[model samples]
Target: MGGGGMGGGMGGGGMGGGGPPPDGLRLQYKAANTTADDIQIKPHFKIVNDTQDNVPLSDLTIRYWFTRDGGANFIYNCDFAPFNCIYTAGTFGAATGVKADMYVEISFMPDAGVLVTGDTTGEIQARLHTQNFTLVNQTSDYSFDPTKVDFEEWTKVTLYSKGVLVWGNEP
Candidate 1:
């Protein structure tokens, strides 16, 4: 049988026998206030893939919003890169599995104009508006099992600001 696993009755399992290996892909974000000022916040994110097969990841997106005193403001709306601006080590076939760490850092600059007005203060609430990661076979097959892919729920993180809150819960 050439030891090729293609169909039933073959000693080796079928090509799709074992199917894709279980993937333990995870996307994580870390937030920190680097400046002494409480308003400045930095968010860093990393993607870790722990699967035997090389998974093709594309169309990754993450949306974020910041809120103070019930008022929210959209902060980021773009694709997430693994390292610099969102990193992809390789291209097309050249790309290997995401075994190492890939990440990006974004800084949140609050509207100083609003803070100066002095409405409410001392606490800033942040939440992930939307995050989506799609995985597909190298052959561009959409019918691939969705369960094998990994998706994460919105994550929320809050930071303390020394300044007063200036905006109201209008928009």
Candidate 2:
């Protein structure tokens, strides 16, 4: 799927959950597969450089939060990422919350390159599967959107620049 970006200084209500986007790098998302039940969860991402300065991919991290079905272990895959899907890595972290108990943290290798001002990091198509092949209940995910068919500015999935929150909110 193709990606779209958010320009600098657009103000509005909280994106998908809470917190208006801060002016800097912006994260956009869309669900390739919105089914409530699936063998795997697909979450596509694209990054927009809202600031005037260039932002390196090495300094950024994206987190897609969701709940784990039981004690299921997950395996991550980057089906497509402009810089090279193989260079992107996803790891899970145990978290405590009502909507999300786990999150897939996505990080990029240096090969991903930099995003100049007003530029966007095309599409980062990613998905995860349960090791035991269990279906994922995505409708209740903190970052999953069943109605979003196109890339839009989303806050449910968070973005961090050098470990500082520049966009979205945590569950």
- Top-scoring candidate (TM-score): 2
Please estimate how well model 1 matches the true structure, expressed as its whole-model Cα lDDT.
0.24
lDDT of 2 by residue, 22-130 (tens): 3678899999989998988999999999775666676678989999877479998899987887677787888786589999888876666777788899989998889
Off by over 4 Å in 1: 1-22, 34-37, 59-68, 77-171
**Per-candidate RMSD, Å:** 22.4, 8.6
- Residue-by-residue lDDT tens digits, candidate 1, 27-128: 334443222223223344333444343322221222222322121332322234322222222111111112211111122222111211212211222222
Q: List the residue pairs that clash in candidate 1.
A: 81-86, 81-87, 82-86, 82-87, 82-103, 83-87, 120-165, 121-165
lDDT of 1 at 135: 21
lDDT of each: 0.24, 0.79
Look at candidate 2 and give me any clashing residue pairs.
Answer: none
